[model samples]
Target chain A: MSTIPAELRFAESHEWARQEGDLIVVGISDHAQEALGDVVFVELPEVGKVFAAAGDQAGVVESVKAASDIYSPVAGEVVEVNEALADGPEALNEAPYDSWIFKVKPANAADLGKLLDAAGYKALIGE
Target chain B: MGQRTPLFDLHLALGAKLVDFGGWDMPLHYGSQVEEHHQVRRDCGIFDVSHMHVLDVSGSQAKPWLQHLLANDVGRLQQTGQALYSAMLDTHGGIVDDMIVYQTDEGYRLVVNAATGDKDLAWMNANLAGYDVRIKHRSELAMLAIQGPNARQKIGELVNQERTALIHTLRPFEGQQEGEWFIARTGYTGEDGLEIILPATEACAFFNDMVGAGISPIGLGARDTLRLEAGMNLYGQEIDEQVSPLTSNMAWTVAWMPEDRTFIGRAALEAERVRGITSKLVGLVLEERGVLRAHQVVRIAEVGEGEITSGSFSPTLSKSIALARVPMATADRAEVEIRGKWYPVRVVRPAFVRHGKALI
Candidate 1:
């Protein structure tokens, strides 16, 4: 079973969002990382980029096998992008939950409620 | 449920990630694909290759039959146990499949791709007219490859003294049968190794013994990367039925001498040479952070565009590399379009690494 922290919210596409004050820290779930074995490269969204709605293309995660698109869980503007991932993409596989990909300033913080909660994500992934 | 190899249960017990590969449930990886690739380069690793189709050809006319059936000449195998790589081409000069053919005292043995087994057999049978040849499909056998710089030394320790002496004496591209086992010093990975074809019943026990002796079991994921790094072509990716061996970096495998010996696709290949070859396969190295994938458009400055056939993040090079078919005039530099942006890449000879050393 994958780790689904009760405090975080998840998208059906496997991204997780945690509210840290007005900004939301976003990363992929543990389940997502495991499915994508050994992340070799991560294409993080640029800062100040605007996502008009949830489930928009935020970045890309590439493994040796294939590449997967990462989606934004909520409508937001990119506040800060993870720079460390540019040099050490394996960090996504080693610590998926703790290694946040980007920080987003949500246009509407209420959009987080529309995403799946921890228990809902667990059920969605068939934990 | 797809077709299972003799080592299917053993793979499951080793916690392999199974995937569907040409109607066979094969292990994609045991845990980490990159690790397995490095293991084969730095140390020894074992692979289950029992899914490949093995066939034996024997008869009074077997020599002439193969000389006409394959692009490479069988006459080159001057000594018994010598092996040669050849391309099986269709009438249009397109590659039907590429395989390795070995000569034995009795006759010749061929190992072909599993996915193209039915088609290859049909083609071989269709061209058997007026030839006194008998083809026997050996489905009851299993194949394994143990590869690395230390592969020979480690495998030598496992077998008996006679087989061990054979392992020491077996020259590269040579295979000989010892009792029920046929061991050859040949491998797809660009490393020193042995490819053993043995009875299916003994596969499980032998695999267990190797693993118990501390050889890492590699999966198909690493196999692709290792071959790619070695500049080897995959059947569907680099050379399909629509593509000719001349454009797929396999022109060396085509035997053009002995002009009287006409092979199946010889006429078409000669015509193609006369008409002029347009596109050629080359290697692309992306020094940037993103990965290169198949079907990505490759653009040359003043030349025509081409496409990447096989692309991946090279574990050995620590960079994205690909085998691409580009315009014949493509020079030392090219650009590959990833996502919506164009990234510059360096074009080099198809090979990136060999014998655990970076070639480019």
Candidate 2:
């Protein structure tokens, strides 16, 4: 079973959202990383990009197997992006929960509540 | 659930990630695909390839029948246990399937791809009009490939004295039968290795013994990357019924000499040669960060456009590489469009690595 931290909220597409003050930090969940095998490259969203709604295209995560699109879990504007992933994409596989892909300034903070909590996400993945 | 190999239970015990591949439930990876690829390149690794079909062809007219059936000349096999790689072409010079044929004491043995087995058999049977030949599908057998630099030394320590002697004496591209098992020095991975064909009932025990002796169990995921790095062609990706061998970097496999030998598709191939081949397969190296995938558009400046046949991140080269079909006029530079962005790539020979060494 993949790690599902209780503090994080997740989208059905497998992106995780964690609240930190006014900004929401985002990364792919452990389940997503595990399913993707070895990550070879990551195309992080540019800072200042805007996603008007939840589940919008944020970036791309490519594994050795195939490439997958990363979606934003909540409506947000990208305040900061993970530039380190450009050189060391394997960190996403080694430490997915700690490796945030981007930091988002939510357009609506209440959108986090609409996402699945730890238990709900676990159930959704059939864990 | 798809068809399972004789080593299916053993694969499960090794914590393999199972996936459906050409109607068979094969292991995609034991753990990390990249790690398994590195293992095969650096050390010894084993693979269960029993999903592939093995057929024995024997008859008084076996040699003549095979000469007509394959594009490569079986007459090239000077000695028993010698193997030859050939393409089985259709009437239009298009590839039906690529296979390895070995000269045995009785007659010959062929190993074909799993998904193309039924079609190859049908084609083979239909073409045997006046031949006194018999085709037997040895589905009761299992195949395993032990590959890498240390493969021979590792395998030599496990089997009996007679098998060990045969393993050491077997030349490259040769195979010999030891009782019920047929051991060959040919492998899909470019590494020096052995491909062993044994009875299905004895597969699990040998696989377990190999694992117990510290040989890693590799999966199809690594197998694809290994073969891609070696620049070998994949059947559905590089060559198909619609694609001719002349354009798929497989022109060498087609035997055109002995001009009167008139094999299947010979006339069409000759016509294609006279018409001047337009497109040819070449390799692409992406120095950029992102991976190159199949079906990506390849723009060759003023030459023309083409498509990537097989593309992936090569663990050996530590970069993304691909085999693309481009116009014959294409030079040493091209651009591949990945995710709407055109990334410049260097064009070279199809092979990127061989024997754990980078070629490009």
Please provide, for model 2 over B1-360, each residue's C-alpha lDDT reduced to its tens digit, 9 standing for 90 to 100.
Answer: 999999998899899999899999999998899999999999989999999999999999999999999999999998789999999999999999999999999899999999999999999999999999999999999999999999999999999999999999999999999999999999988999999999999989999999999999999999999999999999999989998889998899888888887899888899999999989999999998989999999999889999999999999988999999999998889999999999999999999989999999
Interface RMSD of 2: 0.5
Interface root-mean-square deviation for each candidate?
Answer: 0.6, 0.5
Candidate 1 lDDT score at position A76: 83
lDDT of each: 0.94, 0.94
TM-score of chain A considered alone, across all candidate predictions = 0.97, 0.97
* Alpha-carbon TM-score of each model against the true structure: 0.98, 0.99
True contacts kept of 2: 0.95
Candidate with the greatest DockQ versus the true structure: 2
Model 1 CA lDDT for position B333: 94
Docking class of 1: high
Residue B21 error, candidate 1, Å:
1.2
